[model samples]
Target: MRRLAIPLLLLLAACSPANSQPAPPVGTKADRLLVDKSERVLIAYAGNREIVRYSGIRFGDAPTGHKRFEGDERTPEGRYTINGRNPKSAYHLSLRISYPNAADRAYAKARGRSPGGDIFIHGQPNAWPGPPIARDWTDGCIALSNAGIKQLWDIVPDGIPITIRP
Candidate 1:
């Protein structure tokens, strides 16, 4: 019994909420969308308050590298706007991220490359047909669960600003 006691106690500790960390502080608004690339979290805020937080988002299949080149398969960093929505997305649904803005174009042009665009925030496809697993999976867009994307579609409007950070 003594030999089993330590293992049992460790298991209990692992399951204890006391050891679980609290969620990061969030505001209560729906104005801004903030993505923390390192944490892979997307927070929706209205003014200074947070409306909701979406976790387990998939990023560019090619993270940790520079974008702005065509076919790089990378998500761009910095600020952008939600320019449009697609009800008939190749995925379930999609919110367009205005990529290749002026600065992005300039940067790409400086390198003699095209700043590839067509970025989006969207849900999994009917073909893929399910929630994202516990890791990143998208080509260069932010992906959410079908249900999560639906909720966001109802709340987020075109022209909202989004900040993607490292």
Candidate 2:
């Protein structure tokens, strides 16, 4: 045991912050994205382990309750998938959320309303070339800072599941 101790200590020293290896251009893959609207935070998980938590999330103007129809201005609640991504998005970058599943469509259709689509987890608008907006201003999408969204874009891939909660 003593013979192995010195080698283990040497390995640890090599991994210290000053001597640490640089992080990869990309990061750990996130299998799941969890958004807590009540807390205004987004949590990314890899495998039962919490990888990243982003705060100061912005929501729609209404910002409460599950979105049901067009122009509702409320973020959707429940299970969805990251179905696609956009680099030429109006926002810095965006990952499409698969809203309006069968149930959502049925619910809206029954009420004679159109279930709005094009929901996404996106960054600030490209035209806004200054400080971040400080209000809940999206039509019904989740908004984060450009840097945060860039990191998410790198780590969270399409086809993963995302759960939005109230």
Candidate 3:
């Protein structure tokens, strides 16, 4: 019984939420955001100084390559801006990403398809139970926790630059 109990406790600890680390100090202003798709992380920066890093991120259902068109189920890669904000987002809070840039539009147009837009860095689903989803789930957006998104919403204003990496 003792042996079984110790192993069970260890398993529970391993399955626990990874967002246990205290967030970095919030800054007065954040100018840049960086998303590492492969690494599944989103980082906020104040100039050259790193202010906040959010790990254990879940990306689009198709978690690789650049998003080219609507319903691609892949996150777009490259430079973009925080073009909008939704204080009453369905998924807690959301910061809109400016996808379908000129290059994106051109590529999709050449392919005779619409380059999808309406990408965002958002929070978890409001209806879900228990902890956050543990896998890639968004259609073509970035997802964080409700609390995480709130913090981000407060700091990262519209027009901030974001660079998404493959």
Candidate 4:
């Protein structure tokens, strides 16, 4: 009975909402990506109107701590732009999120550490092939399902501003 309970717990944890649901499709050109770190949600807005929202984001493994160096597993907090896209990515597909802006670079340089680059808003890994994982598993990068990413690919373009708030 205890062994069965253990497997059940594992399955329950694996299927939890930590990672679930596809992100909303990208809308008009004026749409903005707004991240509320407190809620761990990324919402798309068109001039104060909500269009879509993605939740269950996993931030730096150390969410309460400040990002120090590369691989610190901390999603940056600040204003940035969507600079590019990658059809071939280690993580299925990805939308480049510009991190280490001048400010971030300066801060990291002062501390003698790399601000860590290659931050992206991306989808799940191919290994998870069945479907999007039921919870967050990124190393500080925003993640969407394969289908959600495809939807975003159609709507979002390069040079769009992204505002990330703590």
The candidate scoring highest on TM-score is 3
Q: Name model 1 segments beyond 4 Å from true.
A: 1-29
> Which of candidates 1 and 2 is the stronger one according to TM-score?
2
Write the residue-wise lDDT of candidate 3 on 110-161 in tens digits. 9999998889999888777767777889999999877788778888989999
lDDT of each: 0.76, 0.87, 0.87, 0.73
Candidate rank order under TM-score: 3, 2, 1, 4
Per-residue CA lDDT of model 1 for 81-163, tens digit only, reads 99999999998799999997898899989989989888998877769843354455677888877777877777788999999
**Candidate 2 structure quality by residue, lDDT tens digits, 1-166:** 9999999999865543221122224658999999999988888889998877877789999999999998999999999999999999999899999998999999999999999999999988999976556689999999988877888888898999999999
lDDT of 2 at 84: 98
User: Roughly what TM-score does model 1 have, to 2 decimal places?
Assistant: 0.79
- Report how far off residue 72 is in candidate 2 (Å): 0.7
- Candidate 1 achieves a global lDDT of 0.76
Clashing pairs in 4: 18-135, 19-134, 19-135, 60-73
RMSD values for the candidates in order, in angstroms, are: 6.3, 11.0, 2.3, 4.8
Model 1, clash count?
12
Mark the regions of model 4 whose C-alpha exceeds 4 Å error after superposition. Answer: 1-27
- Assess the local accuracy of residue 95 in candidate 3 as a C-alpha lDDT between 0 and 100: 94
